[model samples]
Target chain A: MDFLSVLQFAFVQRAFLGGCVIAVLCAVLGLFLVLRKMSLIGDGLSHVSFGAVALGLLANMSPLYVALPLVVLASFVILKLTEKGRLYGDAAIGIVSALGIAGGVILASVSRGFNVDLFSYLFGNILSIGNEELALAVALSAVVLVVVAVFYNDLLAVTFDEEYARVSGIKTTRVNMLLMALTAVTVVLAIRVVGIMLISALLILPAATALQLARGFKGALLISALTAVTAVVAGICVSIALDLPAGGAIVAVNLVFFLAALGFKKAAV
Target chain B: MSAVISAEQLSARYNSVDVLQEISFEASAGDYIGVAGPNGAGKTTLIKALLGLVDISGGSVKLFGESLQRFGQWHKVGYLPQRASFSLLFPASVKEIVGLGLLTQKRTPKRLSSGDAALIDAALELLGIGSLRKKLIGELSGGQQQRVLLARALVARPEVLFLDEPAAALDPQIRESFFDTIRALNRDARVTVLLVTHDIGEIGQHATKLLYVDKRVVFYGKFTDFCVSTEMTDFFGTHSQHLICHQHR
Candidate 1:
């Protein structure tokens, strides 16, 4: 079947709709996270989600319900570590990431082994996404996008210089918390599209690629969003054609875009 | 005269060590006070404390008659921190950088309007950086980058401007031009300025008052009083004191 005919399947339509929304959410939040050097946040939170998912499976509960709150809490813990622990961003992320993987490993062993249901989450199964998951992704993505748009100026100010933004009466603490919370939610949502192992690529690559050529802040955001959506759509199509894992395919496509952007930047210079 | 800034028994600490101790002073409208001190003397800490950027360990600070905690009129204040504090390579344009100054004037969903755009243009022109408005901030030279930050501070037309070593990285010629622009703003625009610098001798040329501190208020008064005071003469010694006051004469 051709690509257009492939779109007629219910699962394919749901996957495209859900994947595109999550990709845009990741890209938009990624720009700020990448700029602030908090790109590892997605990876850290996803690791926490891995632990949360294991706990949920062991408890015979839905993993998404368990992972959301647990990951959000982990993000705040990371924020507090950076604030009061006198640690760098990477160090804080590293500590949380290690703890997450360890917790997940322990939980996996206690549960007698990694089950089939757990395997699906580890490597993602986007084509198996149900209507409920699709709806959840779209709604959360809209909320994240609106929050980003509403606080665009404040986010830009804080990202550029936190002290200056605070002196201007922009609530730097609140904005930082909001950014972290939004990132956590995006990471949890993106896991279904790209899996826990490759979620960071979905959160980082598009923004990095856009930064290579974008001249202005808004242009960078626009380019990043477009890059993310394009990668998701093209990756999904390629996965169906080649009978490959969708998550790996999406990340691979993003890597290709990043390499191309780097080449373009070098040539232009 | 009504005070623009008031600090009483103000103190700050870093890692449990006192950076500022019982520092008390007041700045009136249009007063140009030059803040000078040795390295690690808490000059930057004092600025940070006054602006509520750091925790106050002891007393209190008031801005525009309101206590620091209650003061919400940030548009009335401008801060140009040390150049090293900025992330210049963040892919922002000159206009975009300057537009940040006006964000305090807006509420949630803060955006630059067409009128705000006009103000940004005027600020860039005032700093002689209008041609660089479309240019990326990181691509600019050190002098130009400094100008962009100055425009960001100036765009909102703040009544009180706090500059922390703004000309530290400039060439002699550029430094003079920068000081001239500040002096003009103080003289023509009647804007209050608290300039933190290491150049005591150079600051004596334009500042109406001088505030010298090394973790405490060493001296705070007009240049004339500082020049004639036997106490300052004894503290700084005749030759060193004379070097600071020569430009005022």
Candidate 2:
């Protein structure tokens, strides 16, 4: 097919649209994740999502719906464990992620063979976006973005100083819970494009790249979203031209963006 | 004058270990109370108790004649914790950081009111860093950062300000200037101040009310009274009393 004709395919159009929406969601939500130094929490939760997806594939159910509530529950558990268990963040993430990956392995072994659906979740297939998935991703992105915008100042306060935020009556607990909940939801949405395994990197990469290039918090956020969108579109184009898988290609593009950002930062300094 | 804050027989426990016990004190509006104690003396605990942060296992705290439990006017209170830690890599400018004090007082999704913006500007000017508003918060020196943090707390135009070990790691010159600024705030703005610190000597000149705590109220009254009362030497030792004579900015 010609270059223009490839873009005309219905599945290709859906992939690009869904990719854009989910990129915005991941970049925006990931800004705080990277800033607060909880990037691995994303990694841990996404692994938990891997097990949940495994469960769905085994039961002949839609992995997306199944992974949704399960991932949300895991997010709460991770938060409570880190706060009260005397264990550090990495420890908590490690324990939960180990449980998730092992469980997935055990389940897959029992099932005797990995199905096409299960394999899709591991590496992801951007060309498989259905209309419903696209709609859900767009709606959830809007919701997450609204929460970020509305609680921007409060989030900044809690992120900067939890004690001061608490004394200042910022409802820190609620704000934090909201952020965790939004992250869990956004992680699930991002999995369709980046896969459960590499989803956290998708969430964090854009934010880190933006931090290298932008001077202000607001500037970083805006630039991160722009970078994510550009990378998603460019990744899709490269994937089409090279006849490669879009998800892996998108991550490749993200790495390139990160390296370029580092160069620009050094040059500016 | 009526008391703005009254803690009666107050107590606090951490991990079932008693940190403060049956402590009581009162301060009226415009009072500059310096909270002094040795390490692990429950000085921070006492501040936390008044701020309604620590659990009040016994007694009560009253703010503006209302019990702390029922007191919903948290917006009028400002707090700066010990060690003022924040990421130097964070992209927040000085303006954004200071604006958070007032922003936390506001409801979500609300824009800064014109009055709030004015207060922020005034606070920056008050702390003598209005020109540095555009600078990254992490780029400033420790003392400058302290002033910026002070400006943050001041932006709320708080009726009662609580500072915990604010000058802990600052240079001697900066520490003196920090207290000087506090004195000015107390003298000019009528903002009631509660400074929790270990430097008994440095804070002596600035404080109107002195609260000497060691898990209990060792002495609570005028700074002059604490210096003269035998309880001062008893609680702090003869050296503290002798040092009091030479303690001045």
Candidate 2 lDDT, A1-269, residue by residue in tens: 78899999999999999999889888887888787788887788889888888888888788889988988888888788877787887898898888888888788878866566677898888898898898888888888888889888888888887777777777777887787899899888888897877888788889989988776778888989998999899999999999998998898899899999999989988
Model 1 residue B26 distance off true place after TM-score fit, in angstroms: 0.4
Positional deviation of residue B244's Cα in model 2 after best superposition, in angstroms: 1.4
The regions of model 1 sitting more than 4 angstroms off are A1-3
> Looking at candidate 2, what is the lDDT of residue A5?
95
Give the lowest summed-lDDT range of ten residues in model 1 chain A: A112-121
lDDT of each: 0.91, 0.84
lDDT of 1 by residue, B96-134 (tens): 889999998999999899999999999988877889999
Task: Name the lDDT of candidate 2.
Answer: 0.84
| Clashes per model (N, Cα, C within 3 A) | 0, 0
